[model samples]
Target: MPAQSANSTSPAADRPPAARDTDALLRAELGTAIRKLRKERGLTLVQLAERAALSHPFLSQLERGLTRPSMPSLHRIARALGTTQQVLMAAAAVPHPDIPVGSAHLVRSGEGLPVARPGGTARMLGAPAYSVHPVEYTGMSEEFQDYYDHPGDEFVYVMTGEVEIELQAAEGPRVHVLGPGDSICYPGGTPHRWRAVGDGSLVRLLTVQNATGEADRHHS
Candidate 1:
């Protein structure tokens, strides 16, 4: 069978009216967030689609609030936008506020924007538009995971418990173990992964990632 357009929404047909409305609202909000990020980075619809390896028409539909992207597609778009999927998801939770330079957005205790992570709890600690995005993590993956690479630098500081961080170096893969008060910083585009050191224990980390690099803008 031929592939359906990404804008197709037959699955929502069987849902109750209220549920469909909620879904539509979410799609619209997410679409707006995507569009804003794309424009802020001076990218066109076709440019973003090419970077994300998606169809131009589909991306147009997504930005127009006519469709929602799947998780994989969303991840691709997030990477192409020089940001993380978690940031995009959290930003969509509320209207994007316009704050002047030197202004601040306050998030009270336990009110940080939630970010989904397997076997861990993550939340965005800074506003989406901030030059440096900060996310707090309270747990670790049950097992080692694939290396993750993105557009900007990432600095991780372990606040409690033991943590293991692996970085892919030109020589080979290098692993570092850290306890409280230890930190590591690496440039963007470096492949890296991390996990808690011990069995079923609490580990806390604060990660701050910078804005996209010049190379990412021209090539990705």
Candidate 2:
């Protein structure tokens, strides 16, 4: 064997920086997190760009913190990285508080006005990759409509009551009736409609899309 190196035997030689500027440290940490997640998922920059429907140049800038991503853009990147917006946001340093009831951001449909659809509510929780929210419908007569489309896909899981979903496809329409504990997924490009069923409130947990795309309108 060759002679042992002095630096190789030193533990401090391989240690990370103990103190850094807050802003610079945050940027470095965010960059490292993104790079780590990307590598762990075996995706190259080009592949992640394709998945997020974003230009490779923009993503490169984001990776270097030369460009700051908006919430939607961050969500897209997280999805492409096989993570959640909530996780990415947290890694970027958003603060959260704990209370006696639980975390303050726990969302329940009907507690807040609907952001995308009417008659129902959606709460967004966590970073993009690890975020979750609960949706609640007040009554069966309530029919919710929201227009959305993205580069990735979505899964809707019904937790209570029932829902009638109609997905608008290039060829035509596909209808699905979902009950408690039932779930379904479709391409992000498919425009869709949702309506509550039966005589009680409907509840669902939706895994929202995290890609870039224009919303499509469906009339029926």
Candidate 3:
């Protein structure tokens, strides 16, 4: 199949009407994440803008998702929020499949809780999150405090655009470029990172993290 185009119709269009409301969905998800994190840190919009080196109005626009931020701008916001870019990326999501089979929960298109750091929106498929200081874990997850090595499995499936997941091995390092529908999974201890593969076009993924013996068995 051809590589998915960023300017093309959203993949969600082929799914259901509930998924078609993507533009607004993206903004709501991103805005909600920023607002939640800011409140958690007890910093008002003005203070956060100052700390982020962004203007108050622009920050407000960001919180409202009226505009998008470049990756560098997101990095600044992450630092100002006392978190990592990856954490903010994770803020766009929350999930743990260990609960049950068929819970009937639904996170709409581009409607994942904002991972605390800042980036693409995310909704969890499985694997719960850990708690951190100064940032309480509310029932509605929108961000992570930080990432640590823990016992669990990870699976990231590219749904749009392109990505490269680099993994370390005895031979040295390896890179796997994934397009839409491509996925990679690794154990918890394996160190890895995401890299841009092409035009740095926007990419989305269905991320699954499972911390259970069953998942180990499945992967093994």
Candidate 4:
């Protein structure tokens, strides 16, 4: 059996130093974001969990950064908080300084905001206020099974390792395996799933998503 990096729900002590740090930072950022949103909505933890249909203790752990939630769970929480996952992600990142409407922004390497994932880490590489949201996912495991369907145009580029992507397109379900340097782009509202494909070594990919669709949906 291939050795797994760490538990999907919690960080492992034996993980590489960098991975562990990423995990910890992601957890803390996510927790803080959730808590802040909940408070801003004037809802208590119990009320928010009830609305999200999640366990109260689980939400508590999430707020404490002791545990991480799956994509579906995070989506549920986001909806309950009257926001989208992308907006929540923006909140999770280091607060962007208020720049003028037409000014350019820069994000240095390793300065991107960390995002929690099941068996790996994802960083938000785009400025929070940008119209394009770029994220880098690293060390994704084979067990990753988050399927997404939302309003946005998404482009994916494989950086290292192999990835098997399953897309529910207009014609039918399509599965594609991508290697280094491969890329794919699809419109929003297409259900899709992707995971690392190999000896469980982990994979890295960069995804750039246009925020127009999601932003429209958010305000509508």
Candidate 5:
């Protein structure tokens, strides 16, 4: 066959008009989904823009489907919304491969969790309640305490070494010493401080409170 010209139409050009319409619909749906999620979170456009490190005008345009955001921008927005890019992309009607039973990707805490505090490594194994996090506490030269109050609760199970947990209570500070195989449950709203005892690193598996409740149901 003779060489085809660069401007020649390919087989893709023969696709039905519905296919093109579907793509446009997906793009619009993705934008609308993100905007709805932001509104549900009670975050203003400016607040979300600041969190995503995007300009207000650009974010507004994105929410309106007036502009297509780059992958990085999408990633930032997903992070701000406490979700993954895969979820956001799916909202756009993009099909993703199903995760194999034994091949689920491991998300590193150092990469995903935005630790506002210093010291120790906190990794999230799943979506808060459905996950476990391995927190490794090294030498405590600096007092690391960051006040974070979220909606849910957690149970800390000490795997190795000793951990001192100080909960801020109405009466006074409540201190608890936990060792290997020992776990403690406390309200997530309570401000707390953690320190590794001795010079060794202390490892703990922090289970989500909701999961703990489910486990309790099975045992009870």
Candidate 6:
């Protein structure tokens, strides 16, 4: 047998600096957009942070692209910015597929806009003009227990790694551990959570949600 390399399979090794930098670059691009929008609206960082209910330091880091914000946090920020989350998410450096009336939407490889989140990065694939809201999430294995329920239906299909999906049932909570290629669909009204399994393992899945006039989402 060949000699084993030191920690070749470690999570840190798996996640190269280039990938991390790419994520950071996207965050930086997003931060620049937020800053430009904030300036255009004549709102100081303090004012905007207060309006978003986020601490100034946190907001500063976010504006500086020093950290990533979760989807909920971004939602709050978008509310403070007086803009929709989708609009802000669409302005990133990543190319967006334009799905117009009676038109074909084309998305070239590496054109998807990626929004970084806790333990994952989400890419918005569907537009407001579409009948469905689709986002692809890539997450690294970590300890997480976020739960929520919303209006409409949702579908999830795993593309890589493993995950444990927890769904709130009348009896209690049903758990389903899934591997690559597995899929699940259910109503968004049901409370649920998904957690990555195995240390350093990365999980990727596509989520499609109902895209009506508007959908109410309550997070816990």
> Residue pairs in steric clash, candidate 4?
none
RMSD of 6: 10.0
lDDT of 6: 0.64
RMSD of each: 6.7, 16.7, 12.1, 6.3, 15.5, 10.0
Q: Candidate 3: minimum summed lDDT over ten consecutive residues — where?
A: 132-141
Model 1 scores a C-alpha lDDT of 0.69
Give per-model TM-scores. 0.63, 0.42, 0.42, 0.69, 0.44, 0.60
* TM-score for candidate 2, residues paired by index: 0.42
Over all chains combined, what TM-score does candidate 3 have?
0.42
Measured by TM-score, the strongest candidate is 4
Off by more than 4 A, model 2: 1-94, 98-116, 128-141, 144-147, 211-220
Q: Which ranges of candidate 3 are over 4 A from the true structure?
A: 1-22, 25-29, 50-53, 70-72, 82-103, 107-153, 158-163, 167-182, 186-205, 209-220
Which residue segments of model 6 deviate by more than 4 Å?
1-52, 56-69, 75-102, 213-220
- Predicted candidate 2, C-alpha RMSD: 16.7
Of candidates 4 and 3, the better by lDDT: 4
Give lDDT tens digits, candidate 6, residues 31-69: 777787788678998888778777777777877877655
Which residue ranges in model 4 land beyond 4 Å of their true spot?
Answer: 1-44, 58-72, 95-105, 213-220
lDDT of 4 by residue, 1-220 (tens): 2221222255568977976776677678778878977887799988887787787788888898887765567777877876656655654454434544437655566655454566577767764456677788887768648577656788999988998889997789899999999999998778888878874455888998776643333322
User: What's model 6's TM-score?
Assistant: 0.60
> RMSD in Å for candidate 5, one decimal?
15.5
Query: Could you tell me the lDDT of residue 188 within candidate 5?
Result: 48
Error of 4 at 175 (Å): 0.6
lDDT of each residue in 158-191, candidate 3, tens digit only: 7666766667767877878788778787775566
Worst 10-residue lDDT window, candidate 2: 2-11
- Count clashes in each candidate, considering only residues at least 3 apart in sequence or on different chains: 0, 11, 19, 0, 0, 0
Top-down TM-score ranking: 4, 1, 6, 5, 3, 2
Question: How should the candidates be ordered by lDDT, best one leading?
Answer: 4, 1, 6, 5, 2, 3
